[model samples]
Target: MKPHRHSLYRTFANAAAGVVHAFKTERNMKIHAAAALMVFIAAALLQLDLIRWLFLLLAVGLVFTAELINTAIEAVVDLVSPQVHPYARIAKDTAAGAVLVAAIVAVGIGIGVFYEPIRGWIGSLL
Candidate 1:
């Protein structure tokens, strides 16, 4: 008998659960979650233009997605190799580096989107 396909809601629920799992299982994911929350809050507080908000959200999502993938890669690598191996180390490091690159790009995007607004706020406060 063929397995039943999940409904749309079930798929979305599973995806959300996986995201939560990623955040719980990965330290970097937790950090990314905190940063993403801050960016989201700042965006709302600053009342960013639609385009700017979209860009910020996209960047934040990219970083989070990259981190989740990195965590998955590391888990698979560890499961396959359990023992320390140079190739396994390389695989894990490469996955981590990809996440780092995504994070850096996100940070740059966040700065570009928020710098002027933040500076103006600081200026007003001084």
Candidate 2:
């Protein structure tokens, strides 16, 4: 069936449904969401500068995008290859690797953003 052109609100609602579906179906997506929330809280508490906040946003967005793409890849792979196969394995593994790399990069960025404030806080407590 040809797709219908959705109204603006419906389009937004559909996008929100996709996000909810991902969070429901994908453990990694849920974890990324939690991490993102924590980062936002930290950024707020620390009153992170604009540059740092931008970096945090970029890192979080990358992870979210990577995870969504990974989910789509896995769903397509499963639909196309219902049985175990080497090529299917490769596709899923590669998609997972993309998420892993994004998560690692986000962690590195988080450290860069939080290190100084955290260290200073620790020093004050000592």
User: Which predicted model would earn the best TM-score?
Assistant: 2
Pairs that clash in candidate 1 = none
Q: 97-125 in candidate 2: lDDT tens per residue?
A: 99999999999999999999889878989
Worst 10 residues of 2 by lDDT: 116-125
The clash number for model 2 is 0
Segments of candidate 1 deviating more than 4 angstroms: 1-10
Candidate 2's C-alpha runs over 4 A off are 1-9
Q: Which digits, one per residue and each the tens of the lDDT, describe model 1 over residues 9-122? A: 999999999888997888888889899898999999988899999999899889988888888898899899999999999999999999999999999999999999999989
Lowest-scoring 10 consecutive residues by lDDT in candidate 1?
23-32
